[model samples]
Target: MEQTSLNLVAIAVFVMTLSALLSPALNISPFIPAGTTLGILTLATLDSVSWGGRGLTIFLDLFATPQQRQRVIHHEAGHFLAAYCLGIPITSYTLSAWEAFKQGQPGLGGVQFDLTLLSDTKTIQKTPLIIERTLTVLMAGIAAEMMIYDNVEGGEEDKKNLRAIMRIMGISNSLYQQKESWALLQAKNLIIRNQTAYDALIEMMEKRASVEACQSLIQEKINQIEVMT
Candidate 1:
């Protein structure tokens, strides 16, 4: 997927460059933006593509402003915070789809927990508690976006991930909707409950804290929350 996406991006860049070169002869200024739009549109239309998937995400990342970068940091921090509160050990996190692509990870960006811990205990089963915690983590990014922007758009990948997990558990559509809503509410409540710690973690993450630094920050915040409650 990564190679295929890299190839597609290379082709798109080539097309856009060719269009830019020809724009002078055609006396068209819109040609460059037009070609870029066309490239993005083509990538968007592919059935294999998800919102933050490799092909078009790199384009989005290229044009993302500083505010957008901060938003991604906050979004990822939400996942890390929620997981930490739930006792999930985060192994690493990324703030850019491009970074995730380089790491051979799916989705735009995310906090990766150490799921390998489960392997030592038992076969990881899709029990109710697991599903609930998973849903909360899945919706935490959306919750963060909604809190800051009054809207959310980056959770498409999260929703897709949730659906795939639910499918494995044989969850019904109605139950899925209920669980999603419940989990989102839980995530929002947790964020609200731990707002100070969450904000501190976001600041730490925005500064490009390393994995060990992030884990330390996470633990500190979680400990504070525990003391408070």
Candidate 2:
């Protein structure tokens, strides 16, 4: 499924790039703003390639050092750990561009979850637990990064995650700054408690596990948690 999506994205990019290259030669007015066109195409390509894998992998060879990759592993592990603890189902995870290209979604790497609970119309009246758990899960990635690296990079994605959580909690963006620190702290605690799961996740990432592998790993972890509790 992911491979097919990536092929489509690659074809789109090729067509757009070809059109851009040929426009001047054909004596035609540029049909689109070149900068905007390239920017959109770049984002689309990135999203398409990185959906189920680590977004950083695409640029890892060009920009990231070994330490940075380790940091990303921990960062993503934090997210996977927290979501698992919160009873969210993880569909897949990856740490390679080819995997992302195969899954073909967007942004950098991501841990896909079952959002069916959020979609339950009967649960329309939201609860505090839901809101808090959601925010903690969203902040878990950055918290994990900070825990290992003592700093953070690529936080824009985290902020977007936070914003979405806040929106779901019925809080406005204006209130995010006031609430973010506490949410991050909570996420850190969740990550700490689930350290074992985090470790397993990092190991899987180091192996460049594919979506199916990730799914199986997460399911096994979830079962372990279920048995323990």
Candidate 3:
């Protein structure tokens, strides 16, 4: 997500230079844009080839605005809530790339599920339910973004994860699209139906609540909703 943002910055710089937007009023050093572009591209390449972009990821987080951090929190909360509903146990979550580095995810930050179950999930005929749940969990973040923004700005990583898992299950490329579409709908419905619980989860996460506390609070909120309904 941060990488995408940075790449856009580089592109914007080049565009501004070509259009001579920085000619009269912004009479700054020409070396500024050139050096900035070069530096950004270099960091992007190095970050990609090493530590999964952890260095740049952490650097970006330092200057991240409150809204940017909230987006991260909301995105991770979607994953957390989906995993809980699907009975897929999550071990932890990290909202920023730095915390993700501490959690060993580096450039990737989100809910970490106990994915050991995936090793046992084969391409057998009887495992369709398991497969569906896993796909929905994978699409949850994208779904949340869609629900809130009416447009998803992230989820390339989610798509890659889904594709990799599908390949592991011996699913064909053609069916992958159909499966992803279905899972996205399922994830949207899951988050929308449990709005109160989802909002509570986001709040807990924003407060930097522990995994245990978040889960417990979710259970409490869900129980109340269930009883009231």
Candidate 4:
């Protein structure tokens, strides 16, 4: 929900910037309104990218300080690790905030995973398991941050995370609550088990590694986890 709003804002900004930049060349008299509208559209597009889970979050984090970026990396790693443990296949991952920013999206970081719940065509009810796994994955990021920082930064981003959880809970009711707790436990365990990978991810983030580099590192780490399991 919040991501959608941010995308709208980003689209608006982009449209405005585009119009402003082109107004002089176009010799337009109504540049102000045109630029403003264009900017709004740009912001909207960015928000869409974020909601679509297109690495916009990673792009936005590029402006963050090293400490903040490290925190984000750890946070995202928690999510990835938990998902992996739950048998969720990751599609790709990125640590670059610039990539996200250029894409005009929200969130400082994110990991994309396959949303498919089963491999077979049988219609067995796996909704419960899927919901449980997803909630656990969502909370894993905060759990990771909490484990390391002892608490979160209490920023807009953190609030967004909390809201997302709450929204899920509202829809899923008690089931979501139960799954969230389970997810947190799973995340904590994964963090402990994959401390090395977590450390390496943070180090890579500190160096502002490109998306490709981050993806490669994460894949390698995933392979290591598979070997250990």
Candidate 5:
């Protein structure tokens, strides 16, 4: 997200420079038209590039410090770790908004876990345990952000996903909120219990580990944690 934002800014600067240099030769003011066009395109691109883009994602990407990046890492790590602990198969993960954008994901970044094991088809009657696990995993990112920042907005997509799944499961709005709260509590407890493993996985993810390697490492960590406990 940050890189794309910078690229757009660079493009804007280039356009400005070109307009200034060409204005004298063309005997026309191209700055206004060019700026306006680029501004529209930039905003459109930003909208597509991230779920939290409008003001939140863009602000974090461009101006957030190193500590802020760490917060994001922790947030994503929560999802990754929770899914792993609950026996979900992680296909891949990302912490780059641009990468998620290229993949047509709505969120800034996320852990991609396979849900096929839960149900053969989307319309199938999902088991209670599967729904419970899914909800907990869905709320993991929010729980992590709240744990660290004491507040969060980055989990909008997560909440949306949770609600969508609940709707499909025929859960009502009142029940959905209750489930969300319970899921968050479950996620927080799991994340805290598996902090060391989560941190190790986060380190590997930061180094851009492949999906297979991540799966292997996650399983290894889970096994180690189980054995110790």
Candidate 6:
């Protein structure tokens, strides 16, 4: 869901109640409010447990403006492109809750990296560069959002992912903020450096292009950047 589940439900309840109150003067069916509420809950439940709440996202996103949609594409593209540039294998990605659900992802939208490397704790501990790469990847989405929006709305789970990695490293919380700033700057610079590839990625990502296709396109675009420079 773009908004929190609780907030969405609250908004639904408020609107239904308002509809009920206005039904008398508006000559709308008195049962309309109750029916709508029940229908929404039924759909929400079915979609949640069975469909990763995909239908709900579709419903809610019907109200989402074009800018909001673009923001999501841009945000995920940041992660996808950064991972590609860092020599990380990207497995898949999604641009919406429904697409994510279809792909069996737990969350609404994201770029997925190779789990084989991610699950290897031994390799990570042996290579501090791995940590640097992971930090930059995690910060890339937020950095991308900040690039276009000048602030961030997404990346809550991203921040949590970073904190978990820090805990695994036994790093002190005191340095968390500084580390985050550095990571963001690193990711932002990466995005800026690959501006053309990043732009191409946003279009492909929005269309939910295959990882292989985007991978090919990214290399081609980066080569073009190299040629021009």
The whole-model lDDT of each prediction reads 0.75, 0.68, 0.81, 0.62, 0.76, 0.83
Tell me the TM-score of each prediction against the true structure: 0.72, 0.62, 0.81, 0.53, 0.71, 0.86
- Sorted on TM-score, best first, the list reads 6, 3, 1, 5, 2, 4
Task: Give candidate 4 regions above 4 Å deviation.
Answer: 1-63, 102-106, 118-124, 154-175, 204-229
- Estimate, for each residue in 1-229, the C-alpha lDDT of model 4 and write its tens digit: 3564465466666767776787789986666757668665565466565455344444444456877766767777777666666767666565565545554543443676676653222321435566556666767787888899999652345334534644643545545456556667876777787777767766775575654575567668878888888
Query: Sorted by lDDT, highest first, which candidate order results?
Result: 6, 3, 5, 1, 2, 4
lDDT of 3: 0.81
- TM-score of candidate 1 versus the correct structure, residues matched by position: 0.72
In model 3, the clashing pairs are none
Write the residue-wise lDDT of candidate 1 on 152-189 in tens digits: 86787788877776766667887878877888899999
Relative to the true structure, candidate 4 reaches a TM of 0.53
Report the Cα RMSD per candidate: 6.0, 9.1, 3.5, 8.3, 6.6, 2.6
Reference-based lDDT, residue 63, model 1:
74
Tens-digit per-residue lDDT, 108-195, candidate 3: 5788888775676453335767777888999999999888877876788889988988887889999988999999999999998888
Candidate 6 versus the native: TM-score? 0.86
Looking at model 1, the pairs that clash are none
Model 2: pairs clashing at backbone N, Cα or C within 3 Å: 2-102, 2-103, 3-102, 47-105, 47-106, 47-107, 49-100, 53-109, 55-108, 55-109
What is candidate 2's lDDT per residue for 36-131, written digit by digit as tens? 556755755665565432343354324557776677678777877777778666777644444554677454556666766666534634566765
**Which pairs of residues clash in candidate 6, taking residues 3 or more apart in a chain or in different chains?**
none
CA displacement after TM-score superposition, residue 9 of candidate 4 (Å):
12
TM-score top scorer: 6
Error of 6 at 91 (Å): 0.5
* Poorest stretch of ten by lDDT in candidate 3: 117-126
Considering summed lDDT, which 10 consecutive residues are worst modelled in model 1? 117-126
